[model samples]
Target: MQKVTLRFSHNNPSCLPDYRNHSRSLKKVLQELNIPTWQRKRIPFLYYDDELVAAIGFFVCQAYVLQESEPSLHITWAS
Candidate 1:
């Protein structure tokens, strides 16, 4: 699994890419996992201190397991 951070504010920051762009990025990544269209319609989320900060799974990822072999889980973030 990979780690990422996303900061959201009323005024967009130059450091962070536009949140609207997450759809395209998520689609590209989920394509590899063969995520269904229905799931794709689901929203992504982000949390801060157990508080929901954003619906931006497309923004930041938690963990993904592509495959498993006993105690092993082959997980990779979409580039």
Candidate 2:
């Protein structure tokens, strides 16, 4: 069995690597979406083992994206 986890933390978005292989700040993306400052830290971050898989409601990491016909995890975010 694999270990997957979901965490909610006030992390520095600039430190998270994007699917584009760039270190773009998640804060900037959230700001563009008009998300309030107080709510940014409440977003859930998905992880597979220790690697970041996706930031719920945002982007999924390149390496973790599902390929055609590949097995995948179905995640649903509520609230």
TM-score on alpha carbons, each prediction: 0.27, 0.67
lDDT of 2 by residue, 1-79 (tens): 6898888863544534343556566676567568898887788887777666677887776666679999866867777
In model 2, which runs have C-alpha deviations exceeding 4 angstroms?
10-21, 25-34
In model 1, which range of ten residues has the least summed lDDT? 8-17
Error of 2 at 18 (Å): 6.6
* Candidate 1 lDDT by residue in tens digits, 30-79: 45457676775554444343333343444333232223544743334353
Residue 23 of model 1: what lDDT?
30
lDDT of each: 0.39, 0.70
Candidate 2 accuracy as TM-score: 0.67
Best by TM-score: 2
